[model samples]
Target: MMQKKAVDSVMEKIIAQDLEHKELESNFWTMSNHKWALLAWASAELDQSAALVHLDWHWDGINDFREPESRGELSALASLDELREMIADRDRPVDYASFIAPAILFGLIDEVHFYCLQDDTTPGLSSDLLDETRAKEYRHHNIDDLLRTTAKLSKPILFDLDIDLFNRATPFYLDGPEYHERIRSFLGKCSDLIQRAAVVTIAKSPSNYWIKNEGHYDWDEELAGELFNEIVPIVR
Candidate 1:
């Protein structure tokens, strides 16, 4: 059985107070890498179990996060640099593609509803750390499915987005205008969910070369900015 650490720290209390005061200034974050979202998720003052709505171009469910020696391991992560060192453990491999598994296993999130532009080749996550008894996983191929599932979630939500969701296998896949429109449209549809989320993490993923196409190194960064602009008004 997974041992869940108590989340009654002073920071958590402060977060609760902030929510009570309608002070949501710091609940949203943008990171250069996807794994750093772990920091945002851990820092939030959410219920023992929260629902995760992840939008990305890839599944990111590889499930190789080093098992925490104690339940407090995630709560102990103080900074993105510390998280970088933790995920850098070569043998255990807690990377961008695997960070979600630890969050679920550690009880920060109890269920995941995943959406990706990529086809649903990965049916589901099957790992030793994750079983039927642990977190539940749901996959969606389009915005309609994601919205339908999210509308039914009763738990506090952690909304995660990877800018690569707008990427394709080849360079200049959708053209500038169409790509911008798609990003805006998707965010517009999810604005209500984004506003209700207890925590929101956005990944820039500029170095995702496999799906980014060889020469288009900074395209995702551009898209990340576009995503940021789109989200600002909704959360404001």
Candidate 2:
């Protein structure tokens, strides 16, 4: 685990928006912050035409607001303001579930390689709302296929990892040693291609209505810390 000061310093580089230290310590902080931090970090660090490798249990590719029609052609060089406008809805500015859709629509990501538990043909992988080009840029893979394929990615990569990818069960019920090994091995394979990375460790909360885990409301700060430690050195 990083010392508080070290973690704060790293976060300072990644978070382009204002966020209080107290909020970082809170388990109930907005999930959008986590997603945006990764986007901000990648925007600042990577070259053009970077690829986003999203590893999660759920496909976060939903175009919830359908901003593409009005936004027109979104350039990869889009400003943060433009990106913000593309994601905004009347009730909320950016939703965790739908943030990736805006990222794709805004051309922040040239290509998306999604690794999930489900097959490529699953309903969650459907890109019915996206235009043809955007839909073609998306490729799906099974989570466990990382080890089987020797495919190499030429473009710089932004790794978007959600902790829930490890298991559907509550964090309390997770197999700690096995999860650590899996994370370590998977990251080891992809580290060479990664330019930056973002990790989301969400604790089930009422505000996040999508998460159905009915366990305790406590955040898995320890697991987050462990994953952060494992990731930071490789990306840095």
Best by lDDT: 1
Count of backbone clashes for each model?
0, 0
Best by TM-score: 1
> Which lDDT tens digits does candidate 1 get at residues 16-60?
322221113587776555776766787775657889899887788
Each model's TM-score, in the order given?
0.70, 0.56
What are the Cα lDDT values of the candidates? 0.66, 0.47
Candidate 2 lDDT, 1-236, residue by residue in tens: 99999989966644432221112421212232334433453344345555666666566665554465343534443575655444333244345555665555555565667766533434343455455445334445654454233146555555565555544243324454765676567667766444233322232211232232324444454444455456544433
Q: Tell me the deviation in Å of residue 186 in model 1.
A: 1.3
Mind sharing the TM-score for model 1?
0.70
User: Candidate 1, residue 150: CA error in Å?
Assistant: 0.9
lDDT of 1 at 13: 47
- Model 1 ranges with Cα > 4 A deviation: 1-24, 66-92, 119-123, 168-173, 208-236
